[model samples]
Target: MANPSRVFAAVLPAAGRGFAGNEKEQVLEVHTVNRQSPGDRVREVQVTGTAEVCFPADRVSVCVSLGNSKESVAEVLSSVSRRLEYILQTLRQHGVSDKDTVVRRYLHRAADLYHMDAEVVATFSDFEKMEQVCSVLLEKLDKSVCVGTPQFYHSAGCLSQLRRQVCVSAVENAQQKASEVSQLLGQSLGPPLVVREEETKEWRNEDGEFGSRGQGAALLSHLPHRPTITASSRVSVSFSLRDKSRKQL
Candidate 1:
């Protein structure tokens, strides 16, 4: 006997009533005795795509630390406070704002010596000014201030804009691939059924880590090129498919 047409009947739960254990059995059923006209079947195509873009680092961050061993907590604190004030003044004179500086202080007792330390982090957008600032710290602050390696990075607004662009490019890639497959199969591509972001990642320059040295003015010279800031995205998309006959005119 010929197989009956596939029938999809949704038996939803009754008002204020529920089925126990046989819920799956109650919701759907297939019968071979009687047949109804077949309806259009929903179909989907899934594809994965990725995109990446790199931008030059537009900002630099310099970290400096001051440490002093004194007889009493008050003395140590007083000394560190003076050094911090001087550093802040120097940075401000070079066009660095208070918002661009971060200050941290600590006090500890170790091996019968009272250790007090202060750290100052300043960010700069102008490369020449950064160089001037670093040079002045080394010359004026002398051995008391230990300069850290300079960090190269992009501004937050720059990164956020790039991320949005990359995501859009990834989705466009997925749609292109799906359209090609649909064409090959003599089907029409419909609107996306599901669009999802699978992953996002960053790729850094592999040459060497910047500002690895604990003290440096010479090291700054070696950091000639700004580090590359890469933005990347991957997406998994599911698009609906329609038969040739069902395609829109």
Candidate 2:
């Protein structure tokens, strides 16, 4: 037989690597350990957490699309440009600063999606501003009538802060759950064997739907009231186990 000190090797496959697309990563890990000493250990577990923080959204976006069609494509574009300029200027006159007021989307489609001759868009920070701008455009600007949805957004700073707070809360929850499990198993809770993080920011309608009939720009004119913000998050923690068989049991 081999000596007690002889080393052993093992191999295991894992799911894969993570991407930066989301607030968290979806992955599986494989660990291979050699019990070098008498007291060495090997254990595996899976844990997950869902944590979230809700803060009043202070930002919004609006899009206004206008169009015109002359005999030639160039004439149509020129006229459309003129109309959009007026609308954008109207928005600016009403406290919609250059920074806050942006042209969101511009398209030269042979066929108008809204079935209008042409389209242009203006984005704003919130509903109050959007309402004011909307009023001015309807009252003063050309009312050819094909508008897209107005979007709502939050700054990176706000999202980052909320993400941190929610992640910490999730970690705390996972720890509590782990302690309970350890107690039930008649084992002392040990430090976290592994810590993994995940985050999510979801926006839902009042009815809990993923999206609404008029999302972003489309909702601007259709919505009776302004839209609101909705966000959520989740986290996971892993702990090592030493569930040795107790002779008593």
Candidate 3:
């Protein structure tokens, strides 16, 4: 039976609507469907096609966190604050500005030793600046303020633009795919009956992860930046079949 629900959100609460045993009923229905024999299978499924397009990021947001531990919270924060100030200086020297940077987090945790963790972030004029920033931190932050490295991001405006561009490209890609399939089947592409969307997340500065140091700790050589960012999307679209005698959907 076709689900009357229009959206995924609608389906979730559909069974929960002011019922005493709604969850149990839903479980039973799910089990019943699982046990039911295979009814109709669409062997020739027209997968809604997917298209990917990459757009250069105009601005990048990054988060750089620093942490250290001593005794008192004041001592911890003061140590971190100095390192952070130096980092800001390094970035500014390389053409990055305070306006392009923002402080993200400042917190203290009770550990074996006194500790301070700070999250300072900056947007680069160019992505290459990120490399220099990291390098400077690795070199300058010696025996103090353990650097957690920087995280990369794209602004919402950039993401929104890509979504629109990718969506249009996806629709065209679907049409081309359906047309090819139709031709191979000795038919013409019928007007599309249904369209759906799928997307994959990706990162802005896909540059490889920040370099790492070998095993064994020497002040600040054990922490490695685990940079895993991938943006990908998949779409599936199907066109209805129509003959000269049949009307288009």
The estimated TM-scores of all candidates read 0.54, 0.44, 0.41
* Candidate 1, 1-249: lDDT as tens digits: 453665556565556666677653344444434554345447889999899977777788999999999888888888889888989999999999999999998899998779998899999999789889889989988999999888778898878888898999999999999999999998899999999999999877733334355566456656655777677999999999988896377
**Residues 33-60 of candidate 3: C-alpha lDDT, one tens digit per residue:** 2232233332242756676666554555
Q: Which has the better TM-score: candidate 2, or candidate 3?
A: 2
In angstroms, give how far residue 98 of model 2 lies from its true place: 3.8
**How big is the positional error of residue 2 in model 2, measured in Å on the Cα after superposition?**
36
Displacement of the residue 41 alpha carbon in candidate 3, Å: 31
Query: Alpha-carbon error at 135 in model 3, in Å?
Result: 2.1
lDDT of 2 by residue, 1-249 (tens): 322444444443334755466545443444544334544545544577777666544466666766555456666667677777787677767677776655543444464432224444555555677777777777776456444555555567776776678778888888888877876877656667778777677663432222354656465444543334456656678877655454333
Clashing pairs in 1: 149-211
- How far off is model 3, as Cα RMSD? 17.6
Ordered list by lDDT, greatest first = 1, 3, 2
- Report residue 199 deviation for candidate 1 (angstroms): 5.4
